[model samples]
Each structure stands twice: as structure tokens, then as C-alpha cells.
Target: MADPLPGDVIDRVEYDVERGKVREFTRATFTTDPVHTDLPAAREAGFDDVPATLTHTVVAGHQRDQRGFVDALGLALERVVVGSVTWTYLRPLIAGDHVIGTRRVVGDERREGKRGGTMRVVTLETEYVAADGEPVVRLEEVLIERGEQR
Candidate 1:
């Protein structure tokens, strides 16, 4: 029963703010928006209580579950492939906030691609909330279970 798929609940995710994580994310992502990478600029821009970039918050929400999901399926990081990723930002995320992410299996379907094999696309819908329980953002990730498309 388990080999076909994991459970409906992915895992609970939490992110504690780290200045290094925020800074490194800003630098590496190549996002030049001052409000996203500069604290002083963000303050001047009227976001005195929050960090510059919300993208880091999004990353935090995601990275929290990568490890657990791998284990759930008895999968090896080396064997699985991240076929695609697309995120729609509903609200701006701020720094210095604790974020919680919860994922659930929203969809599961099998299909055949160009190779005419079976591929399973499992949709994981995640909701990231601020510590106050305010919805910060929502994310939907479609993981293509490659090689399984037979």
C-alpha cells in the first residue's frame, strides 16, 4: 500500500529567522531590488518591522520539508529529480518572522509522456503562515515521479 504513494500529510515546516540565511539568499538569487536585499533601504521604504526580501521566507517554507519528503518515500536524493517548480506569491513575506508551512496531497494522477511510460504527478499544496497564524503565502508544488511513468 505504501509503495504506491506516501501519506496525505507531507510534514510540518518551521523557519527561524537567520541574518546569514537572509543575506546569502539575497546575494545568491541575484534579486537587485533594494527593498529585498537592503535593510536600511527597506526601513526607508516603510517596512521598518520586517526584513527586506520575502523570497527568503518562501525558501524557508520549502527547505523545511525537503528532507522529510525524501524519507517518506524511501527515496534517495541522488535518484529523484526535481522536474519543475513554479510559485505564485500572494503576499509579501517579511524578515524577523517565524513561518510555518504545512503540505497536503492535493492531487495525484498518472500519465504517459513522450517516452510512453508512466509518470505520476503528485501535487503538494502548501500554506505558509506567519507565527500569528496569518496566511503569508500559498505554494503548490507538482512533483513528477520520473521513471515511474511506465
Candidate 2:
């Protein structure tokens, strides 16, 4: 595949926030907040059901597509590093919520590395929308391809 350009749509995936997965995620992350694992607590907290942790999207994203955008771009896995990740939560994601996420290439550029090499920086943005068509979260990830090691 050719290099991905800005505005390129990588893929769209559907994710279901199951109750069991939410509890498992909370336990795995060592999150002690009852709102994530207990439906009653969630309801008391003003949510309809158990609400997933803010970072639960990462798990959902991976479960939907292990390869993700890096593999879609055909970049060598060993040469790529996740530089950073940022999340914007527009609303709560609760158990039983069906979300549709669309991943797109928002920025592509090259920069000179301090060690005398070129680095390819790619910014990927995934917008997750609820069943009602309102956006729930936006995730931005930066992947850096370290040019051939000198």
C-alpha cells in the first residue's frame, strides 16, 4: 500500500461496550472506582449503566483491529513507535452502548531527527460516535517511524 496521506480514511469499526468487558477492564487496570464495574454505583453516579473508563476506547480499538492504522499504512512494525496519545471525551460511554469509530489520517509530515536521520510523523484521529450519531470520544495517536538507523 502507498503511504497514507492526510485525510485518508483508514477504516471504520464498531465496538460494543459489554458489561463483562467493562468489569474486566476495570479490574485489569486496577481501577477501584465502582462506577466502572457496578451498575448501581453507575446509576447513582448519574449514568444509565456501568460507564467505561476513559481509556477503555484503547481496548475496544485493539479488540476491533489488532493491526490498526500502522499496519494499514504498511509501515514496518519494528520501526514504528507510538509517540503519544490524546483523548477527548464528549460524553460518557456506558455498558450496552454501541459505538462506531472511524480512523483517518489527519496529519503526515517528515522532520529531521536530531541524530541525523529523517523521521516520519503520522497523526491518526479516530472519532467514536454513539448509536444516536452523536460523537462520544475522539482519539488522536501519533506514530513516529524512525528512519533507517545510522
Candidate 3:
């Protein structure tokens, strides 16, 4: 497969921060934090509504979709693994806030694996902004795609 060039803008997506989705995410992640599920509690915490969890951007950013970059690169989902991820939150993403996120290919590298195969590391950096145009979160995710031994 050809390498995806660095600084490639992979996707631009806009999504809403629905309260119901926040509740579901919090419950599914076992994140018993009321701020993430209860509106009143969120208001008490100085938010207008429930706030999304840290990892919510993964879903909100449409990173799980198996199209676009992943498909273009011909990467096998079964051979891909998350190498690392970092999140920097500038502001809480509250329910009802529409978010616009842009994902870019920041880094790409090929390395020899310990098992004598080839490993490709792809790093994607995404910045999400709220409806007000304020930056909400910046996420960097590294994915490793392993190739069979030559």
C-alpha cells in the first residue's frame, strides 16, 4: 500500500453533542460521573448540560468509520492496533454544542518489527471546535498497521 503523505487532511466532520448520546456513552464506559449523564448535575458543575467524556471525541469525530483514509490506504482493520492517543481539552464539550472536527495525517513511518515483519505507524491529529468556534479538544491518535513477514 502506498503511504499516506504527511499533513494530509483526512476528514472534516460536523456532529452534535446530544444529551442522550452523552448519557449512553457515560453508562457504557462505566463512567458513573453525574456530570456526564445528569443535566442538573452538569449545571451544578457550571455547565448548561451534560458534558461528553474524554474519549467521546473518538465517536464524535467519526474516527471509527472504516472509510476514507483507512480504506484509501488499504489497511486491514484486523491488523491495525491503536499505538497511542493523547487528548488535550480546552473546554468542556457540553450537550447541544455542535462540533466541527478536522482530522489530519500528521506523521507516518515504517519500522522493522521484532517478529521480522514491517510495521507502519500512522498518526492522526484532530482538532474539534464548538459551534461558537472555540477549540474544545485536540486529539492525537497513533495507529499501527502490521504487515506479514516478507
**lDDT for each candidate structure:** 0.66, 0.87, 0.83
How much does candidate 2 score in TM-score? Answer: 0.93
Candidate rank order under TM-score = 2, 3, 1
Worst window of 10 by summed lDDT in candidate 2: 60-69
Top-TM-score structure, candidate number: 2
Candidate 3 per-residue lDDT, tens place, 53-76, comes to: 878877753534656667865678
lDDT of 1 by residue, 1-150 (tens): 253343477677888655567677778888676776677887897875336354565565456656767676444455355565555556666667677887777766767867777666677777878788988777777776665422
Kindly report the root-mean-square deviation of model 2 from the true structure over all alpha carbons.
Answer: 1.5
* Ranking of all candidate structures by their lDDT, best first: 2, 3, 1
Model 2 over residues 44-121: C-alpha lDDT tens digits? 999999999878887655656657655787677889999999999999899999999988999988899998989889
Candidate 1 segments whose C-alpha is farther than 4 A from its true place: 3-7, 50-54, 61-67, 73-79, 148-150
- Count clashing residue pairs per candidate: 6, 0, 0
Model 3 clashing-pair count? 0
lDDT-wise, the better of 1 and 2 is 2
Candidate 3 matches the true fold with a TM-score of 0.88
